[model samples]
Each structure stands twice: as structure tokens, then as C-alpha cells.
Target: MTDTQDELPQLMSHQSFREQAREVIRGMIVSGKMAPDALYSAPKIASDLNVSATPVREALLDLVQEGLLRPVRNRGFQVVIMTAKEHDDVFKIRLLLEVPSIREIAKSSPTANQMKGLYDLANAARQFAREGDLIAYLNADRRFHISLIELLGNKPLTELVASLRDRVRLLGLANSGARSHIVQSATEHFELLDRIAASDTESAAAIIERHLRRSRDVWGAGSGPA
Candidate 1:
């Protein structure tokens, strides 16, 4: 086949190519495949993903809006390096929102279905931890938190918290020693679940605060703040 013909598949498909590029690049950034402070462009990434430049540019733009990336002057996009302060800031906001939300949820009490869903999520996190799957563990952890806030039935709040969680993940703060740290973090989920299930909002709030503070310290050490 000619060069042009050979590149046909690389062109945009009828599917959501933009979303695909976004997800692919996102995976690279969050997985540490694309190091922080590294610079890339739409064309460069397009070659990597075997897609056209249009969708790649669109995808990068989306991440820029999400605070995961920044646009360069004449170059492509730069992976925004997240500092320790940024992580702490996000965690502080999480503490503010999550603590009160959990307290409210505790007061109202979780229904049987909500309780079951949370247990399932916590179990998934534990399973991922045992298997040494950091990405899966983080995903399960995010879901657990998001699902709890979802109990409030506030769409905007849920979206903001989820966005902050994603940004935090990109900071490479989830790194840990081994199965032990993973297991400990995942176990904390079950403990928190127990509190919420029992409608102990006060205790749950305290747990939530301590969990976040401990995570901030541990992850801060791994990332070294800068």
C-alpha cells in the first residue's frame, strides 16, 4: 500500500476519536508514562496514537480546560506539573466538602442499597490492592468517595469533587511501597463504610478527616511536594 493508503486507519474513525485521544493521553499522564514538565504537541501525540492531528488537538484542549495540561506558545501542550501545595489545597477542599457531606449522610443514614453499593466498591478496592494494582485501586477509591458524596444528590458538588480527584491523581501522589500501603488504604475504606452504614456521621467525619490527612502526608512524601 502507498504511504497515504497505509495511513488510512490512522485517520479519524466514525467513533469518538477526540475522546479516545483524551483518554489515551490522560492514561499516559496519570500512569507516569508522560513525565511531568514534559512537553508534547498535537502532532507528536497524533503520531503516538496513530490518529490525525485534529482529534489530538481537540483532546489536548479538553485536558487544558480540566487543568491537567497547559497550552504552549508555539509548541503543543505541556503537562502541568502539580506541586505539593496544589495537592494539599485540593485535599483541604475535599476535607471541607467531604466531612460535612458525610456527616449529613450519617445523620440521614444510608439506605440498604446505598450501603450495599459502598460495600461492593470497598471490596473492589481491597481486591485491587491485594493484586498490587495501583491504578485500579485509585479508581475504586475515587468511586468510593464519589459514591458517598452522591448520596447528597447534588450534581455540581459531585462533579467538582470528582474533578479534584482526577487532578490529584495526575500529581503521581498515589505511589506507595507495596501491598502493605495499598492494603492499609483499602482497609480504611471498609472502616469508613462501617461508620457510614451505622449512621455514625460524627465518627465518619473524623475518619474522613484523618484518612485524608494521612494520605496527604504519605503521598506528599512520595511526591516530595514539587
Candidate 2:
């Protein structure tokens, strides 16, 4: 019993480290820091993260299940290349999920905690935008959207949309015109949040559609399987 109890905290710590590594690696792949069609080793990534290989390897395996990376025999993992159609498909899914959801959120009026969380996320995205930290910006953006959608209490739907978002981000859309317009995009998020807080369902829905379309234009143009 003592041995089991002692191992429990270590297991939880490893799980926490694995999740952090997954987020860092995901942001790297999304921001074009980790190019597609390349193999990266667990030991090297572990060294960079200053963590043991166990957690890093576990994190890499988690990404493999997410369709972002694939395992190689001896090599660590290869970033998966996404085609233009695949990118479009992911956006389409987002549009399908988020548009109506935002309308609902506006009608329901967010709770105090939800309002605070949304504000924090929007502010973080805006700050990262001003700082030109593309990866952090994307991470904040993803969390903002996921938190927005999760208000509906649909776990499966949230997971599905989040997976699509990961696929879209891995396309390196933030590396192009999207980077130049980071502030603009972040501002749009702020506006959408304001509208939601005001219970302006129609306007919030409109903002959601326009925001996503602008992202598609900025990131989707001239990008294909790489």
C-alpha cells in the first residue's frame, strides 16, 4: 500500500509533464517551428524540454493518436502533412460547430466564471498578438474557442472540434499573412466576446462567421500538403 501510494504522485506528475510537453510540441508544429516531413527523436525533445524521456515519449504517442504525428520504426515521430482540402474540411467543421454555438452562448448569457475565463483568454491572445508570439497566440486562441464551445456541456463535440483545430493549426496558417494580421484577428476575438457578453446573439454569430472566414483567407491561401 505504501509503495502504491508513493507511485501515485509520480504518475500524476508524469501525466502533468506529458500534457505540458504535448501542448508545447503542438504549438511548435502549428507555428511552423517544426516543419512537416521531418522526424524528431524523443531524447532530443526531452533534452530541450528538460524533462525525462518517459514523459516526452508518452506525449509523442498521444500526438500520434491525434493524427498530427506518426511514429517511425527507429525515428521518433514525423509531422503529418495536411492537404488544402483537408484544411478546408477542418474549417468547415469549425464553422458548423462554432457558429450556432456562439449564437447559443450569447442567448444564454455567460456565468461569472465563464465571463472571467473568456476575458482572460481574449486578453492573453491580444497580448501575444502584440508581442508577435505566434505560437502563444494560437494556443490562447484555441483555448478561447474550446472554452466557448464547452459551455454547451457537450464533451464529445468539444473534443471533435478541438481535434479539427489541431489539424488546422498544424497546417502552419499562422506563418503567413495571418502573422501580419495577428492584432486584427485578436481584436476580432475581443469584439466577439463583447458581443457575447452583451447578449447580442445575431451580431456574435456574424462575428464568428467573419472571423473564421478571414482566418481561412489569411492562412488557407496557397497552402497545401507540405
Q: Would you estimate the TM-scores of all the predictions? A: 0.77, 0.89
Query: In candidate 2, what are the lDDT values of residues 104-211, reduced to their tens digit?
Result: 999999998899899999999999999987777878888988999999899998898789888886667644576567789889988998999999999999999998
Off by over 4 Å in 1: 1-28, 41-59, 174-179, 222-226
lDDT leader? 2
Whole-model alpha-carbon lDDT for candidate 2: 0.81
Highest TM-score, which number? 2
Candidate 2 ranges beyond 4 A from true positions = 1-15, 174-176
lDDT of 1 by residue, 1-226 (tens): 1222222234356569997677666655654556667678788677766778898899999989888888888976777878878877888898888889888988888899989999999999999889976655765777888998899999999989878867765666445554576688899888888888888878989988888777666653567355
| Candidate 1 TM-score, C-alpha based | 0.77
Model 1 residue 88 CA deviation (Å) reads 2.4
What TM-score number comes out for model 2? 0.89
